[model samples]
Target chain A: SAVISQKPSRDICQRGTSLTIQCQVDSQVTMMFWYRQQPGQSLTLIATANQGSEATYESGFVIDKFPISRPNLTFSTLTVSNMSPEDSSIYLCSVGVGLNTEAFFGQGTRLTVV
Target chain B: GIQVEQSPPDLILQEGANSTLRCNFSDSVNNLQWFHQNPWGQLINLFYIPSGTKQNGRLSATTVATERYSLLYISSSQTTDSGVYFCAVGGNGNQFYFGTGTSLTVIP
Candidate 1:
């Protein structure tokens, strides 16, 4: 199994500010995914970050609001631009060795917009 | 896109009891994983059973790829087992679709 480390386990930000969450994996992975879990709700896929290529965002999510960067296979960052109260949620990054393997998740960054 | 559903949204059990959690997906998937989210909000991967069964300590999971459903069994539950269990399925796109999760509370 791979180990994932997420930075700034929790953060409090102003409504107009932006918070970027970083995810680091111990091993190189081909695909990294960003997900959001709203308060008391299930998780939703934000985007798929592939190394050396653009990220693929899901429905109702736009790259302008949730910009993602996958500069390399071991690291990825997700920035919540112009944070709002509605944007306050838990963001997590996950990686799997391949389609046949189980994916591992970071501890997650709990963001609170005030 | 695929739909994932989990049954028994909330569950309460006594310590040392046994419980079963289920996950159903609308379509076939190449990846299926079970996770437990603790109170501190950490998503812990419990199993990566895309198909067949696997066991670890007091936890075990079985996924029927042909039927698009999975089952997780926890034997001799403990207070520390209280948390939310989630099931996620992934396809060719490499993005996972998550279920609402089953919340379990084990009382001492």
Candidate 2:
């Protein structure tokens, strides 16, 4: 299991503003992912952050809205751009150590857009 | 893409009671994981049972890969188990598709 730490555990941001959440892993990992969970709802994947490259996004998410950066194997960031009330949700980072392996998630950053 | 479904959508149990949570997938998978998200919002990995059975403490999980379904059994439940239980699966890649989750409330 990997230890993942996310910064700014919770934040209050105004609409139109953006927030960047950082995720730091205890050790090097091959793949990193970002997910979103609305208030009282299931999680929805936002993208797969690759080390030293662009992130792969899900169906309803795009880079313009959720820009990701994975500068190294142990660090990644997800920035929610142009925030809206609908964008208010808990953002989580996860990683898988191997093929057919279990994934571990961060405690999650709770964002409230007003 | 794989679809994961979990049921019953909501469950209420008494402390020290036992219950079962089921997860169904739309297709064959190489990965199946169970997670418990506590009230404070910490997602903890419980089991990664793609097939067969696994146990840890008072919790155990069984996965029948051929049937595309898995079961999580919680024995001697505690209030600490009150939260949402999510089951996720991956078909070809490591990326998982998650279910809506079973919101379990264990009341004392």
What is the DockQ for all candidates, taken in turn? 0.73, 0.75
Worst 10 residues of 1 chain B by lDDT: B88-97
lDDT of 2 by residue, B1-108 (tens): 788899999999999999999999999999999999988999989998889999999999999999999999999999989999999998655688899999999999
TM-score of every candidate relative to the true structure = 0.96, 0.97
Tens-digit lDDT string for candidate 1 (A1-114): 789999989999999999999999999887899999999999999999978888999999999999999999899999999999999899999887676677788888989999
lDDT of 2 by residue, A1-114 (tens): 899999989999999999999999999888899999999998888899987778999999999999999999999999999999999999999998776688999999999999
What are the Cα lDDT values of the candidates? 0.92, 0.92
Show pairs that collide, candidate 2: none
Chain A superposition TM-score per model: 0.98, 0.98
Could you give the DockQ of candidate 1? Answer: 0.73
Q: Write down the worst ten-residue block by lDDT for model 1 chain A.
A: A96-105
Task: Give every prediction's interface RMSD.
Answer: 1.4, 1.0
C-alpha RMSD by candidate, in order: 1.1, 0.9
